[model samples]
Target: MASCAQKLLEIIYNRRSIRKYHRKPIPDDVLKAILEAGRQAPSARNLQPYCFIIVRDQELKKRLIFSEWNRFIEEAPVVIVGCGDSRAKWAVVDVAIALQNMVIAAEALGLGTCWIGHFIEEEVKKLLRIPEHIKVVAMITLGYPAEKPGPRPKKSLEELIRYETYE
Candidate 1:
């Protein structure tokens, strides 16, 4: 069996922003595990001021389209809207971390996820009846992958990391 670190590396290195998906739906147990991973993410002050809206209704998914490029969202088996409290200073970061946790968990479970960053906040809120006190941080589309995407380019560690301070 692989060590935890090795397993995590495999999951991270293999993950891709999957845009196309198979028609099959995710199993309930698997979906719960993914959501649980998000629930366990660390937050500032441990406030965990994040909430996720799971969208499986086909009609609702169709109505979520705010752009032509995002039409693939409606094709996925599920779409999760990550929202955070507007009053929390770290709400956006907290929600992003939680959603990333769910992304990694979904990848580990042989599922694909795509982060949906472009959307009209007002439209989404109106469609989902989200409260005014909450902000839509992001959304993610999840499902079985229909395409095997190769790894996209990334900067080297040396290029991305800094030892101490800006020179």
Candidate 2:
């Protein structure tokens, strides 16, 4: 067994952008934990101006996936839509931080998540009846993963790092 910090590091290293998911629905408590993680995320000036929409209805999920690459969203048991207030200066940034927290929390809890950024925002807002004042910043799919993918190649630290200025 690994220590808490070790376990977290392991989870971070192993986390994947899971698209294929099992049909099992996330437990109420687990879902709450995930949401709480997002809620706890820090926002600029402590505004935290964001709303989350939980979608489990098959029809709605089916309608939300507009891209072929994101079609797997319809198969997941849960989808979390992060909406931010356009009036806020850092609305989308706040929502993005929260969404990343949620994704990490889901991974730690034995669930998988995939952050989806491409979609028809207007269509989604119209379908969900989101207020005109709110902006649909991002969407995420959550469920038990059906596939385990190997790690993809990554750039070396030396290649990406610079000392003081552009190298």
Candidate 3:
């Protein structure tokens, strides 16, 4: 059997932005585990000024559509809206880390996730009744993937990394 670290690396490497999903619902316990992963993420000063809006209602999912590229938002079984407090100094960064945690956890559990960054802030706030003091950091769609997509192109270590300093 592979070590825990090796398993984690495999999960991270295989994860993709899944756009197609099975029409099945996620179990409550599974969903809770995914959310718990996000909740356990570290935050700046441990303030953890982040909240997630779990959207499961079909109508609400349809209403969240804001662009042609993200039409798959309505197809996923769950859409998690990551929000952060405006007054927090590192709200955006904290929320992003938390959401990424959830993504990793979901992938580990044989689920898929897609980060949706395009949306009208005001429309989302109006539709979800988000507070004025809170800002939407990003949204992620989660479900059982219907397709297994190969890895996309990426920069090699030689091109992306620099030894010690930029020389």
lDDT tens per residue, model 1, 26-63: 99999999999999999999999989999999999988
Q: Which pairs in model 3 have colliding backbones? A: none
Model 1 clash pairs?
Answer: none
Off by over 4 Å in 3: none
Cα-based TM-score, every candidate = 0.96, 0.94, 0.96
Residue-level lDDT for 62 in candidate 3? 93
lDDT of 1 at 121: 95
lDDT of each: 0.95, 0.94, 0.96
lDDT score of residue 63 within candidate 3: 87
User: Which residue ranges in model 1 land beyond 4 Å of their true spot?
Assistant: none
Question: Can you write out model 3's per-residue Cα lDDT over 16-103, one digit (the tens) per residue?
Answer: 9999999799999999999999999999999999899999999999988898988898889999999999899999999999999999
lDDT of 2 by residue, 1-167 (tens): 55988988998889999999999989999999999999999999999999999999999999998889999999899999999999999999999999999999999999999999889999999999999999999999999999988887889999999999995
Report the alpha-carbon TM-score of model 1 versus the true structure. Answer: 0.96
| Model 3 global lDDT (CA atoms, 0 to 1) | 0.96
Task: Find the 10 residues in a row with the least total lDDT in model 2.
Answer: 1-10
RMSD of each: 1.3, 1.8, 1.3
Could you tell which candidate, 1 or 2, scores higher by TM-score? Answer: 1
Once model 3 is optimally superposed onto the true structure by TM-score, how far is the C-alpha of residue 69 displaced, in angstroms? 1.4
